[model samples]
Target: MTQSDFDDGNEDDVPEWADRVMADVAREVRRRRKEMKWTAQKLADRCEEIGYPIPRNVIANMESGRRAVLPLVEVMVLAKALYTHPLRLIYPVGYVEEVQQLPLTYPVDTAKAMRWFAGLNENYQADHRMLHHHIAHASALERALFAVQGEERQRWAAERAIDDTARAKALRTQADFAERAARAKDELCQVRSAIAADGEPLPDLPDTLADVDPAEGYERDTD
Candidate 1:
C-alpha cells in the first residue's frame, strides 16, 4: 500500500498542520464535486474549459490525499470551475466552528479567520495607512450608491404592490437609503479634504457624485 507523503515523512521533514489542512480541503473538494453529481473527468473538463487544466488523475490524487501539494493557482482555478469562492474552500466560514489559520497560533473563530483572510477584519483595516483609509472611504461611498440604487428598485417594485402599506414601507426604505447616501457623500468629501491636506492629489469623484463639493471646507482665493 502506498503511504500518503505526510504519513511517510518524519515530523521535521513535513509541515503536518499544512498537510492536515490539505486533507480538509480534499474532503471539501470531493464533497462539493459529488454534490454537483460530477465525475473527476467532468471536473477536469470544467478546469480545462475555464483555461486551467488539472488532469483527472491529478484531481483524483488531490481528492484521495495522495497529492502532497495544492498550488495557490490551482486553488483559484478550481474554485472558478467549481462555482464557489476560493475563500469558502480554504476556510469554510459557516461550516466549521474554528480553524488553525497559522502554523503556531491556536485555532481562531472560523468566521474571524475567514474575514482576516479576505482582508475584511476591522482591526487589520484600522492599521492601514492614510491612502488605504482614503480608498476605503471611497469604497463606502460607492457601496452607499449601490444601496440607494437597490432601494430605488424596491420603491419601483412597490408601484406594483396591491397594498398601500407595502408601498409606504418601500418608500420609507428608499428615504432611509437616500439619507445614508447623503452621509456617505459627506464622509467622502471629508476624506478628499484630508488627502488634499496631506499634499496628495484628490482622486476624481464618480460621475454620480460629481455634484459633491470636495473642497467644501477649504478657503478659495478671490482675485
Candidate 2:
C-alpha cells in the first residue's frame, strides 16, 4: 500500500486516546477556520501558498477526524498560515488537571449607579428642575460677577473663576463615574496558568473577548 493509504488505517488500529485527540483537533480546526471566516478551499489555498502540500480532501479528512496523524512540520505550517500556534492545532483539548482555577469574586454593580444617575435627567420635568435649580443658580452667580465694576469686578471674577474650576472638577468626576460604570458592565474572563504534565501552560485562550465600540454607545465586545 502507498504511504498515504497506509496512513489511512482502519479505525480499530487507533487507540482511544489518539481518537480523542484527533476529534479535538478536528473540532478546533473547524472552529478556527470558521472564526477566521475562511472556507475549506481558502485554507487549502493558503496552505499551498505556504509550501505545505495540503489539499482540500486532506483538510476535509482532518476536519472529519479521519486523518489522525498530523506531522509537526505541517502543524507549524498550518499554525503560521492561520495565525495561531502549532500546539493549538495539535493539542486542542486542554488537560483540566493541569489548569489552575482561581477563586473569582464578582464586583458590585457600579453600572447601575451610573444608570440611575443618568435616568435622573431623562424626564423633561427633571431636566427643567435641574436647569432652574442647579444651572440657573450657577448662571445667576456668573451674571452677578459680570455685573460688578472696578475692584468688586476683579474680586467677583476671581470668585467666579473658582466656581468655574469647581464645576469643571465636578464634570471630570462625573466623567470618571461614567467610565467606571461602563467598565463594571464589561464581561471579564481570567485564565490562570498552570504547569502541564510534561509541558508548559499555553498562554493563549482558544477564544477571547475583544473591545469593540457599539455604533450607538460603548459596548463590551466578546465572543
Candidate 3:
C-alpha cells in the first residue's frame, strides 16, 4: 500500500517522504497487531487500559492507511501497547534495509538510522563522543563476562580429564578472560564518571557491575 491509500485530502501540505513514513508506520502497526493475534478492538482496549485510549476506528483507519497524521505521543503509546520500542516501529530495522533519515536525504542503513535516533552513534553527534565510548565499554564488559563463564566451564571439564597439559591450557585461558573482564569493568566505571562529569545523565550499570564505584577511579587519579 502507498501513501495515497491513506490520503486525508491534505497531501499537498505534507511532504511525500513524510507521507511514506506514515504509510510504513501503518503497515507496521497492522503487521505487528496481526502477528500478536490482536484484533482492532482488543488493541483499542489495551490502549484504554494503558490510559491513552485510541479508539477502535482510529486504529482501523491507521491500519488501513486512511489516517495520515500520526502524533509522536501516539507512536510512543502504540509502541508501549505493542511491547516494543518506538524506534522499532518507526525504523523497522530488520524488516527493511534502509530508511530515509530526513526529507530529501538519501536513505541510509536502517541500523545506522536507529543508532542516530537513540543518540548512540558518535558520528551522528561528534561533540558528545563519550556516550558512544560508554556503550562500547559496557558491551565489551558483558561479552567479557560471558567469555569468563565459558572459560570457567572449560577449565572444570579439563580438570575432570586429569590431563595436566589440558588443565594448564584451560587455566591460562580462564585467567586471560578474567583479566579482560576486570579491565572492561574498570574502564566502564571510569567512562561512567567521565560521562557524569560532562553533566550528562549516567547510564545504568549492569547488575554485575552495579556495585563498582566510579568515584574510586577518580580517587585513584588524585592519588
Determine the backbone clash count of candidate 3.
1
**Candidate 3 C-alpha lDDT tens digits along 1-223:** 1123233444453487787788777778888899999999988998898999999999999888788699999988899899888888888877877776766566678788888888767664475566566666577667656755666777686677677887887788778777776776676666666665665566665565665554454432232
Model 2: per-residue lDDT, tens digit, 86-192? 55664443421111111121112323323333353356445554333444334433333332223343444445555777656555555554454344323111111
TM-score of each: 0.62, 0.35, 0.56
Which prediction has the highest TM-score against the true structure? 1
> What's the lDDT of the predicted structure labeled candidate 2?
0.48
Sort the candidates on TM-score, descending order.
Answer: 1, 3, 2
User: Comparing 1 and 3 by lDDT, which wins?
Assistant: 1
Q: Could you tell me which residue pairs clash in candidate 1?
A: none
RMSD of 3: 6.6
What stretches of model 2 exceed 4 Å from their correct place? 1-14, 93-223
Give the per-residue Cα lDDT of candidate 3 at 62: 88
**Candidate that beats the other on TM-score, 1 or 3, i.e. the better one:** 1
Candidate 3: where is the Cα deviation over 4 Å? 1-14, 122-126, 130-189, 192-223
Which 10-residue window in model 2 sums to the lowest lDDT? 96-105
lDDT of 1 by residue, 1-223 (tens): 1113332334542476687678767776888899899999999999999998999999999999999999989888888888998887887665666766766556677778778887777766566656475776678678767765766787786787779988888888878877877887777776666666656666766677775664355433233
lDDT of 3: 0.73
RMSD of each: 7.0, 23.0, 6.6
Candidate 3 TM-score to native: 0.56
